[model samples]
Target chain A: MLEVRDIHTYYGDSYILQGVSLRVEAGQVVALLGRNGAGKTTTINSIVGLVPPRRGEIVFKGETITRAPPHHIARLGMGLVPQGRRLFPNLTVEENITLAARTGNGSARWTLDAVYALFPRLKERAHNRASQLSGGEQQMVAIARALMTNPDLLLLDEPSEGLAPLLVREIGRVLADLKAQGLSFLLVEQNLHMATAVADWVYVMNKGQIVFEGTPQELLGNEEIKHRYLGV
Target chain B: METLIIQLLNGLVFSMLLFTMAAGLSLIFGQMDVINLAHGSFYLLGGYIGLTMVRRLGSFWLALVVAPLVVGALGLALEYFFLRRLYGRHRHLDQVLFTFGLALIAADLIRWNWGAYVESVPPPELLSGQIPVFTVQFPVYRLSLIAVGVTLALGLGLLLERTRIGAIIRAGVADAEMVSALGIDIHKVFAGVFALGVALAALAGVLGAPVLNLYPGLDFEILILTLVVVVVGGLGTLRGAFFGSLLIGMADTFGKAFLPEFALFLIFAVMAVVLLLRPSGLFGLEGT
Candidate 1:
């Protein structure tokens, strides 16, 4: 479980996240829906300590990690699938996964074998450089890489950004399967349909604050609110 | 024919020395993005330390082993005290200014301790004799220097290309923040790499002492030449360093043999041509 309470983050003099609060219970898929510049990516970044909140409290599991560095936060079981997938272009698929591997996550830890089983396309291209992989394959490698860290909470920033429709559906299936395996995910997405397909609890963010929190069904039934807040 | 053969051998020997001298400089710049203008000073310090060790222990082998460690420790100290604070500042000017100043202080210290004298330590006894190559005799010491440098280059090539740590270093070169995000202590990697670079510089000093000789102003000369090597080879690649050193070494050696008046200008001329042709040097990533 992760809880971010009333956090304000900034980039120099420009204020970004303004007193935003959200939470995800254990093993739940929490989709943060927002338009561009709505501070969804900034929210995830603040949680992972890439951009430390100017004033806020972030609790992971139980302990406060608001002031911890990014590496320390990563070590404490927060895996990030950065925007653009950010795979080391020069590294082979295996090398990219192994670099992010953290041992002793628990009995159900995700090993290279486990990840390879999940994404067989990556295994075929194990020796190939990440740059050689297609976009969908690169996104798979990114998720597998984060999984290799055996993180309790995975933060994804815009997973469906540049994917084809078929690939987006495939990614949704993967997330749904992972949720069934008791994994937690905080997905930052602009695609309303993909967010609704996988997420249990939906939170709509507007101008750096969470404006709506409801079940996916509740969100889908409401059109006026979606048109006003999400421009959908 | 004999003169040509002799010059060819000399050029090869000098090329290898240049490779060894420039390797560490290129590596530190590649990994930490630090110019380390004080690297030549580290080389001078190593030679002086090796000379002192040989005089005291009466053993060239022991001096070779011990001197680099002392110089490497000094390098570690430099990183810990000075360079550690400057990571991610995006201003390399501070590093250039600080290290250039350090090089000056190092020269004064050497002059104060060694009395401004030019000295050349004798090669180890096994390498003291001459070996006939083709139509001419070459000093065994120079031949050994080539062997040492080539062996080092091969070893370094393996280290960067094949191993896991090498993969990490290569990845770090591409994106250091991602490397840190993967839970790696990137600062530790930087410190160790800086120390390794320092050790290589000291090794060059100890091994090259007989060939290059030792003096206070030697630092500036070597530093400028090494800068030429890094710039001409490409700023952040081993291939650039190797090829750059090779070209400069051959040019310097052959220029002296055939046209003594143009020897000094030949190195810069080669650099000018390479830059005009490639802009990023011989091995630099294009448009980088």
Candidate 2:
């Protein structure tokens, strides 16, 4: 479980997230839906300690981790599939996965073998450099690399951003399978259909603030909310 | 035929030495994206420390073994106290200014301690004499230098290609943020890498002092050569550094031997062609 309480984040005196707050329960997939420039990436970055929040607190499993460094936060069982699939271009697929292969919680739920099983294409191109892979394959490698750490909570920022339709559907299936395995997630997604299909709870963000919170059914029924905020 | 063979051997020796210096500089630049003007100062430091050891203990081998360790520790301290704060801030001008100042300071310190006079290291007695190779007499010391340089290069390559830490370093060069996010403390990695780079430069200096001669101004000359190597080999690729060094060394050696008046111009010409054609050096990765 993760709790971000009234956090304010900034980028060199320009305010990005003003008193933003959200939470995700254990074994739940919570969607943070927002349009462009809604501070979604900033929020995710703050939680991961890549961009430390200037004010308020971020707690994970009852411990305040606001001031922790990015590596320390990662070591605390949080895996981040960062936006834009920031894979090591020169490294092989296998090397990329193994680099982050840490059982932070001392559990071997997602080992290299398990990740290979999840994405067999990764095994096929395990020796190929990441730059040689297609966009979808690169995304899979990024996800598998994060999962190799066996994180308690996975943060996926736009997993379907640049994928084809089939790949997007496949990503949704992978999320569903991971959800079945009782792994918690904070997914920042732009695709409403994919988010609704996979997420149990939804939080819509606009202008660095959360404006709506409800179940998938409630969100689907609220046409006015979707149009006004998400522009769906 | 004998003249050609001698020149080729000389080229190989010079290439190996250049590789020893440039490889570390290239890796550090690639991984941290820092233009370390202070790199050659470490090289000078190594030579000075080795000279001291040789003087005190009268042992060439002891100086060779100990000087790099001392210079490497110094490098670690420098990175921790100074270069660590300048990461990810687009402060390259600041980096160059700070490192240039550091280089000047290091040179001044050396000059203050050793005086401004140039010093020469005598080769070990066992390696002092000449040996006939293919009917041409070549100094045993030059041969030893070639052997040591080649051995170090091969050893370093193995350590990089076949180790976990090397993989992490290579990955860090490609994307440092991703490496940091993977739960490896990048600051510690950066410090270790900076020290490692400086150590390589130091080792090259100690090994090379017998042939190159050591003085306060030695840093500037070697720094220019290292820059050429970095540019020709591509910015961040170790293999690029090796190839670039070989090209430069061959050009410098052969040009000086056969065409003395045109050698310097020829070196820059090679660099210009490489830049115009590939711009990334022969072995460097594209777009990085």
Candidate 3:
């Protein structure tokens, strides 16, 4: 489980997350939805300790990690799939995935075989450079790279960005499957259908604050809240 | 024809020496994004240490092994205590200024300790003699430098491209943040890379001592040469550094042999041509 308590994050003097709070229980798929500049990525960054919050505390599994470095946070069983699918462009797909393979204290649930089984296309292009992959394939690589870390909690920032609608649906299905297998994740997204279809609890963000917290059906039912905050 | 062959052999020897020096500089830059202007100082320091080891222990081989270890330890300390503080995109100028200052201080200290006299280490007895190369007698030690350089190039290439740690370093070079986010301690990787880079420079210093003799201002001369190789090859890639060193080394050797007056100018000319054609050097990724 992960919890963020009223964290105020800033990029220099420009305040991004002003009093943002959220929580995700174990095995829950929590989606944070907002339009551009709604501070979704910043929230993920804050949680992963890329840009630590100046105020408030983040508790991951029981420990306070608001001021921890990104690597330390990662070692504590948290993986982040960043916004841009920042794969090492020159590295092969296998190298990219293998680079993130860590055998922490856990029994190592995710292996190269498991990742390849999840995305068979990646295996076909195992030796190909990351830059040579399609957007959807790169997204799969990004997700696979994170999963290789064997994270207890995965934080994804815009996993569906720039992918085709069909690819988005496929990603949504993958997330649903992963949730079924008991992986906790906080997904930041602009895609309403993907988020609603996959997420167990949805938190709609607006201006760096959580505006709505409800089930996916509740979020879809409330048209005013969806249109005002998420631009859905 | 004999003179041309001799010069070509000389160029090859010098090219290998330059490769040994440039490999470290390129890797350090590639991994940490820190332009260590003090690289040549590390080389000179290694040479001086090697000089002492060779003289005291009466063993060139011993110096070759010991100098890198000493310089590498110093590099590790420098990274941990000083270099780690100035790591960031906006703090690049600070890194340059700091390393430049270290170079100046090192130059003064080396002079203060070793004095301003030109000192050269004799090649080990086994590698001291000369062998015929196309009607010209080339020193065996110099010829051996080519082998050493090639072996080092292959070793470093394998280390960077094949191994797990190498994968991590390559990944770090591309996206350090993501590497760290994968539960890797990237700062340690940076520190290790810095040590390796400086150690290579030191190794080059000891290796080049016989042919390039240590004297006043040689650090800057070697520094400039290493910089040229790195820039001409492109930045942050081993292939770039290796090929760049060869190109610059040959150009300088041939230029000095034929047109001594314009020798330095010729190296820059090759660099200018390379840049004009491919701004990122031979193997550099775009926008790097």
List ranges where model 2 is wrong by over 4 Å.
Answer: none
Candidate 3 residue-wise lDDT at B152: 95
- lDDT by residue (tens digit), candidate 3, B146-255: 99999999999999999999998988888787788788899999999999999999999999999999987988999999999999898888999899999999999999
Instruction: Evaluate candidate 2 and give its CAPRI docking class based on DockQ.
Output: high
What's model 2's lDDT at A167?
A: 97
- Regions of model 3 farther than 4 Å from truth: none
In the predicted model 2, the residue pairs found to clash are none
Lowest-lDDT window of 10 residues in candidate 3 chain A? A98-107
DockQ, per-model, please? 0.60, 0.83, 0.83
Q: Give candidate 1's TM-score.
A: 0.93
Summarize candidate 1's per-residue lDDT along B1-288 as a digit string, tens digits. 998888877787777777776888887887788898998888888889998887788788988888889888888888999898877647698888888999999999998987788898999888899988886888999898888888988998898878878877777766777777666777777887788887888888888788978888888887888889889999767788888988988898999899999988988899999999989989875545
How would you order the candidates by TM-score, starting with the best?
3, 2, 1
Best by lDDT: 3
Clashes of 1: 1
The 0-to-1 C-alpha lDDT of every candidate, in the order given, reads 0.86, 0.89, 0.92
lDDT score, candidate 3, position B178: 78
Report the TM-score of the second chain of model 1 against its true counterpart: 0.96
